[model samples]
Target: MNTAVSQQPDAGVLLELDGIGISFGGLRAVDDLSFKIRRGEIVGLIGPNGAGKTTVFNMITGVYRPTDGRIRWHGRDITGLAPHRIAEAGIRRTFQTIRLFQDMTVLENVIAGQHLKMRQSWWQGLLNTPAQRREERELVEHAMEVLQKLDLADVAHEIATSLPYGAQRRVEMARTLVAKPELIILDEPAAGLNEQESAGLNDTIRAIRDAGITVILVEHDMSVVMNVTDNIVVINFGKKIAEGKPAEIRSNPLVIEAYLGQDDEEEDDPLLNAVHDQVNA
Candidate 1:
């Protein structure tokens, strides 16, 4: 059941997962999942609860190693690299639940994310060498620039957890951006956002892609997934079920069945109804 991407990745391809799978105990959490992300494209990975969406993100970011298959980035094999090495390789991610340094100021949190990119060694930092001092100054400047872009500059000095929920989410994104990632994996970013905030987040995602960073997101919000992503990959029980454009996915029987179930009465479910409205609108 190898579902790996068939052809060799072209120059535009930024990531490729070939027949990747992982298990816990005797249960296979993710089985033979594969997908490709092109440079500068926003790809949405969507599925029902327990579909192993976040598990895929875990594998890609090195939080967990796949028991089978390969992960390639820029045509280089990085299947089981350490998390720090993965980040160093230009991949960064956000969690479904915001993982921010609650006690740290918005600016400081972003600066923390830039630690890997900093050239200062432990000794240099301990001694506060001239180069270390210079790097610190540059890091602050870069963090501020990222905050400004995310519209969080005004709250740069505010504590991370003290901000409003939407602002807090933006802070997390700002932190990830400070890492200068080539591919950003956002796990359920729209989860707790209001309609207005979700819309704004959608715009922010597009802006990130426009800036030449590739994005792969796992989200349950159909509207955001439909509006923001250039392509959609659907999974069910850990295996890929459907992959296509928004319009195609909206009308896909497999996706519709997976989300809304096959029951005739469930066909009018709110999520499916909204999908229909969006497709028509």
Candidate 2:
């Protein structure tokens, strides 16, 4: 990881992955990978398919604990915290697949994302106390505000899973944003959208950043990655190969070779085979 340039001592780093790695059985899925994310910046984590991008996301979000290295949240050692605990600690993430509530209205679905921050206890909800009602009203107001920001307010009362695919993606993002996380990890948010929808996504992501939330975006769309990110961290076979501004990453010989090289199938086969054997072992 050539990251000396990326790790500034004075940069307001919100998250740090120090030599983080994970393995499956005996197969190393991710090696010693590291990067620093400054607060309020959109950082792109990109590589070819099967580059362990989502594995890194899983480790950061506590779906998978790292076999090596430390993960720090705002200078606190948060390695191996349970997923709910991590979410409570002001970190949230979206999945590659949209996970909206099937039957809930869009506003209701987004309001649910704030459960970790809900002040009313279960007993209060059970009792339908005045305080609980007040809290509910406040949360509903905030969720609608977030939906307006995501351009989904018009559909706030629509069934969430019934919206168009692009709108569903925005709903998932609206759900994440409603939580007010300090850092949001988006896993391929633009995966199924057309060009216009992708363009809308770019604006939405920038709005999130401008609101002072640091973002770690794992995306395959080059236009989105190149147009939106403040910095890019490139990986292949689970190792950090490049980290810099998008323009710099765009021209780097190593990154170009990794993405455009003719022999990638052969190059990636060894690690692919190792993971396959591990899964079947």
Candidate 3:
């Protein structure tokens, strides 16, 4: 099932996934999905469990090459690039499960993100050369700047495992930003947050856009999507069912039926009801 969107002039497209299809054994996980992510836009990808949301993320970040497709970053073929190479090409991402160095302090976690940016060679870091020392000091300063920006400086010295769940999520986001990627893909960023915490995340996401980076997020919280996303793409049975603004997605019968069929009455998530009620309110 190929899905297509015509190119637009004003909102320049930053990422393009064309004819992307991936399968595991005999089952098709993602089928011929195509979409354009505009520069500085917040695009949400939503679907139920087993909808191939995370599989698409893996393909984009080089965790897996698509069975069939071409991925373009800034309009250049980037398919099958090594994960580190993709990171170097201005793309960074966070996982659904927080992947942080638990024993490492928050500051160290952020500093680790800059490993790619450090100019010093392995021998320099190993031998502690003056140039390496200076670069490490500079990386710390840059990491602190990121911590301050994310309001994580208060816990900068604490062990990452000591922070609350929401704070842990923030730290992961700070690490992603530390890489200074032009495009960021967030997988289920609001997964464990409460209502108020999710709302705060909405503000933080908007701040990222204001800072001139594009965000592609996969979230189950309809509230966050309605409140933050500039555009949305809905997938079910590993195929795109709808693509539009929050308002349009909510009103689309096919989208409603897709989720409603699985579990009616908002599917045991207040996030969905929050979106619907807010829309009616």
Q: After superposition, how far is residue 250 of candidate 1 from its true place, in Å?
A: 0.6
Question: Candidate 3's C-alpha lDDT?
Answer: 0.85
Q: Which model is ahead, 2 or 3, in terms of lDDT? A: 2
Off by over 4 Å in 2: 1-11, 262-281
Reference-based TM-score, model 1: 0.91
lDDT tens readout by residue for model 2, 1-281: 22113323435878999999999998788999999998888999987677899999999999999989988877777888889988988899999999988899999899988888899999999999999999999999999999998889999999999999999999999899889999999999998999899899999999998887889998867778878999999999899999999768877778766765536455554323322332234
lDDT of each: 0.87, 0.86, 0.85
Give the per-residue lDDT digits (tens) of candidate 1, residues 1-281: 23233455677999998899999999888899888899889999988767899999999989999999899888778888889889999999999899898699999999998888888899999999999999999999999998988899999999999998989999999899999999999988987899999999998898888777899988867888888999999888899999999889988888877876645775665555665565467
Worst 10 residues of 3 by lDDT: 1-10
Which one wins by TM-score: 1 or 2?
1
TM-score of each: 0.91, 0.89, 0.91
Q: How many residue pairs clash in each candidate?
A: 0, 0, 0
lDDT of 1 at 36: 88
| Winner by lDDT | 1
Give Cα distance to truth, residue 68, candidate 2, Å: 0.9
Residue pairs with backbone atoms closer than 3 Å in model 3 (clashes): none
Error of model 1, residue 107, in angstroms: 0.5
